[model samples]
Target: MEVAMRKKIRRIITILGTTAMIFTVTACGNRMDTMQPAASYVADFFDIPDTVTGIERLLLKDDMAYLCCLEEDGTSYLAAMDIDDGKFLKQNLDLDASVSLLDFGFAPDNSNWAVCLEKAGGYSLRKFDNSGSQVQSVDLAGVMDSPVISAVGRDLFLSIDMEGNICVAAKGGNTLVYLFDNNGRFLFSLDYEGNLMTTTTTAEGKIGICATSSDRMNYDLLTVDMETQDWSKDKICLGATAGLYGGVNKDFYRFDSSVLYGYAAGAQEGIPVFNWSDMGLGTSEVQLGECTDGRFVVLTASSNQTEVLSYEMAVLTEGVDERELLSMVSLTATPGLVQAVSDFNKTNDRYKVELTEYFPYAQNVSNEEWDNAILNLNTRIISGDMPDILDMSNLSVQIYQSKGLLEDLYPYMENDPEIRTEDYFENVFEAISLDGKLPYLTDGVAISTMLAGADVVDGNNGWTIQDLEKVLDTYGANSINNLSGASFLKIMLQTDGSFIDWNLGKCSFDSPEFVKMLEFAGKIQESSQDGCGGTEMSDTYAEAYEEVLSV
Candidate 1:
């Protein structure tokens, strides 16, 4: 059997003004390290209002940037600025208790900008002219229960196609998108059972909104007839864009509903290849300024500052010597971690880390389902289709090490100047080390602490079993029943005796000391099972006994 050696590398890429980088990887060969800037427009900087505390929504139309900025007093104002010179033309419309700005765009050949504001279980479709004057306002009150429905105006899109002026705003949480005309007339709505990713126009000049199912796999473009308000669905040949948290791309050039359409190299091509590769050069929910003379502006804002990035769309559409390869990385997905990975990828184009999923629907999975997914992934690893990163937080590092699947990372850490052992939290190296060999690397450390109602024991520096027993006695018999299964296990481990001998991978649960721990567990179980001390259990002893036995 041939053992394949996998190299895990960590490299930092500097991003400043359209930097293009390349990294070549192949089996049994030298990896070329090259860095070059691409032929894209350089980034331009601008300053927003010093009092501007937060950005509620952003939109760009006809070379002008529209921003809904929240002031330090929590008041939102609609502001407009020139994309070319970053000059604030005008603003003063105050909108309070605003939830989200749904859709913002221009009417067909109209200079006025229409925006939908969500607030207090209602939808306010307001139109503002170039000078920020409110010309029209329509309120759809009682759309949802305010307290119950926290997220309003989650997705807002307006498209003016050959069909008619159409507006799409999320009515419910991943449930529906209400449609309307340019005059704030409620046309119709489509029952969309997914999170809206983006809105694009079909080549035939039709309006379409791209959405992903709850599983984040189904990418469906829901189109609506602007004339008749009729809705239709066509499945696009691409995996769902990583919602708002995940950076998404625009699909601007596809007309035929029968043909597969995807964004490749900044152009819509007839390809259905599901590229889970991350270019890192992308955006979340951003405002695209008017495209004029083959160039466009990207406006992005945070709480304190705003930035404008100019780009030559034509240059982007054309091929450059640099290539952005999508590097696939598999990890247990969480919002914070996903955003972190997204930010890291955007830092440099040399390597884009795309996260692969063990299952199509990773969220809201049962423990049994998660176990099965891991089992399936382990089988894949056995067949040599291992992911670049294992994300051992969700899997057993010991099992991988025992199977000779995990490589020792100590040498890599030692040789890499970027990584320093002293920078990590105490005991991390010892905890992740197996047989004097490091097998796992965690992004961060989790500190464990105990919460007690009124201290009864000296547990500050750590206490012994006798100290714990005194604490329990002080709290009385009811405390034992309140202890969860995990708490019971922790106490036993902290008290004394080892469950497993790491070298032999064998547990010593049958030993006399282990029996004492089991007896303590039984005492608590009996109290709860017998309905003593105001505690009750269906089958406490059986459940508790099985928990210990499994360990």
Candidate 2:
């Protein structure tokens, strides 16, 4: 098989040309003024145990921190720690590796807590006493249908009312919420349509759920009576920019860029609880829980490559020489960027970078939502409220550059003593440069190439549209490779230098060459049914290419 593959690759290299593409980390040259630094609202940082490799859920009640922790060996357990002394109180009730924990929370009476886990059969509701001892385990396989269980979504919520009644809500094709008595007996179920936004249990033991409306513009707050199995819903407008963070006992927290607001049941107005800027935290992946004494506990995770390296817990009091705030915006708050901002804030006393994620929950958003977010960002830029830095990975650089919104970094690079053009890859700078101006600076570059055999192209290193057509005609439609039209177009666009004339600030997409390429791509896509082009080269193929390149 290896020898056959090598022969096929060598034949193909005769027809295609090598293409190199670069991906970059872009940063603008905008800095805000520095302000006087004062103490932050963070009371203290608590040290967590080394045994706790990851924290899935963190809850605070009665000055105790309850965490559903995972170990290095993939086993998980419930842990409790004293907030004041940062001492471990209990670390018991271990779960098997096969059981996947969905959510965990405390009972309203504070007597015990429970973790909702999903296993092979279905869901398991395991109750634990305050001392972290296993009290009761309820298997919910018989209650919910297999189809519903299989299609269960990640927006699951487990809430315990004042009477110790358990409510398990899973959002899938339909939002199905189940209620169980203290003894684990199934009580009632509430089936609703639309996506689940947030869930909360009121002080009166009523379970409240906020779900999206059919129009997707408003929210429907559904409050269920656990005792009577009756429910009522009210439609509320949460604005275009407001996002439901989470819900506590009686209040559901919604946030924008800076402020987190709390809304009570059936109330359209929200009260400002706290501002993220005042907390001195950079990332928005914060977990906020209210304590019994009216204080709030904030949990933030220090992560690397999406893995939790450590967890930091701080207390948010009732309320900074305000550090000069450098606002940075991105669609998603990547783990590396979050870690860098946290480190910068820790070391710098004058200025702090505040990351504002327009779509923090990017995984669950729709295309319309993305468009709306981009529109909002464009509006902000037009209004002169633009952020100091913009992560342009998902944005169009050409439009920004054409509109004169981006500043050229060439002057800054020339003036800075630390920046030397000789130390970096000069070709990359030239490739991305627009009319001798560098609009942004990148930390790295990536290369992508496509190899063609010299024999197919008359031993020429490069070929034009006519040459590609002749080769295609000779080899038949499926000869080049079984790449889809879209995939082929993307590669061609990246490699074609004539398509975009950066010097003239124009594009030749409507040219005859581009049209011909599109026609060829369409023909190839239609001829290949499976679209299995072996687009990615294997390790053996790469090794062979290295040998071929050396010649």
Candidate 3:
């Protein structure tokens, strides 16, 4: 509030943690100077909850994270955690029969979870609530006919061989498909994964599933329509490999509005395992910073330690490492909610939504609400009203500049480079060359950012950390304005920057692990390429460990 109070609080914080000492010095008409703070300014973090156990996967909705974990006594449990506070709110459970959890079924309200019993040699998929109350289940004895089980909306779906069947049953252990309404009343089965299960709706209303089959590949690429289910093939695998249909043909890294993204893997060479796009479905995909979607996409690489893909603008599109991004939302729920699916779906279309409902990233809001927002925006746009949601990313800002939404900084920079350098916008600023002229206007990525994330000032090629560090020190040290000195320090301290850059489209490989594997693979490559005219293929490789006989 007051200057003295602010200074006192800053001093106390410095004593507690690493606080940068910021000294302001003003010169007449020359420029302002700020003394660099030696320490970093990491936000004071609060204590997190300790009750969580076996939280292997979490799907955050609004502020709640629907979590699944193996409990203390070797039982599977689904619980809700408050993301902000890390508080364990509640859990939903159905049958506690087997010791292993196979899958969690999808419904409008909550979900159904499947537990497999090997002794029985099959699974009994049950609808359970957050409290572990069982609402319904399939009898394992007879369910052997169709072992594969998946949930679409409120209906239970089963796949025997290549075909899909719908199942619904009351509070009993029985195997059935195509239940009448939400009750266990058997209506009919389909020759394929339920007809409604595929091509049933858009990315909104009905869920769409695409399942393609391949006899060669060990796994399949099961495309879950972000909406409901449009279509799904039985043996489809991602990053395409040859199969029954001609050959794998699709861009491994592609994104459209309806499709949003697709991967036809069998494209390109040396870049076979190239991680790309934000909506990736791989285990190694990096977190592309954090999203409002609650779950963060880990960046296989980062620049300036702040935003992802912070390297200079180039044709080489930085790829995101898609590890945590492949998460499914609302894994499990109470069986009562599953049991009540019939009335709920019929009662209100609003209640029937996708698995990840209302998540911030791919938020599943009511079409009515979404349409209302869109319409309101249109009305405002036509009526000369300002924008409501204004979070346009760095790339979007470039477009905004073209549209004349940004202020031209040419005069300011030209008048006084010393004074102008003090107030750089958020994130990295990309300087655009105007008609092959001198340093012109620049576009900022954030309120403030490092120069490494920005374009090259010297040679104008390659993202060199040395150049970046130098520019940041200049900006961070000399500017009276807020300098993102903390970003550089944080990245250096918290991460392996060299490894990060390798993954950030610099090294031209998936990761250092992949690179090391390739280097190791070079030794074996000679032997493996005997068919490729290697002449003499070496079959041996260096090993760090040798397990000898027991002495």
Best by TM-score: 2
Give Cα-based local distance difference scores for all models. 0.46, 0.60, 0.29
Q: Write the per-residue lDDT of candidate 1 for residues 1-551, one digit (tens) a residue.
A: 53332112221111110110111111111122222222233234455556665554444556666765555554556677675666764465433446444445555645444455555546566766655567777766654244423464334455555434655545355645566665667776666677665665554555667676555545556666655656753444344233311012334423121111234322323443121112222232234432434343433333112353221111112132253444233424433334445456545656654455443222334456666777776666667765554545444455667777666788878999998889765365665466898776555433222234334423355434454455456655445444543445554464232577645777778887777767665545544433212323333211111111100
Task: Kindly provide the TM-score of model 2 when superposed on the true structure, using C-alpha atoms.
Answer: 0.68
- Candidate 1 displacement at residue 32 in angstroms: 17
Better of 2 and 3 by TM-score: 2
lDDT of 2 by residue, 196-310 (tens): 7656565445666667766554466677776468666454555432345344543666654445667776788766665454454434345666665656666665544356456
Q: Which parts of model 3 have CA positions greater than 4 angstroms off?
A: 1-62, 71-74, 89-94, 97-99, 109-121, 129-132, 146-181, 185-551
User: Candidate 1: what lDDT?
Assistant: 0.46
Error of 3 at 282 (Å): 11
- Candidate number of the best lDDT: 2
Error of 2 at 150 (Å): 7.1
Q: Write the per-residue lDDT of candidate 3 for residues 163-207, one digit (tens) a residue.
A: 122232211122223322233333343223212211111112222
Better of 1 and 2 by TM-score: 2
Name the better of 1 and 2 by lDDT: 2
What is the descending TM-score order? Answer: 2, 1, 3
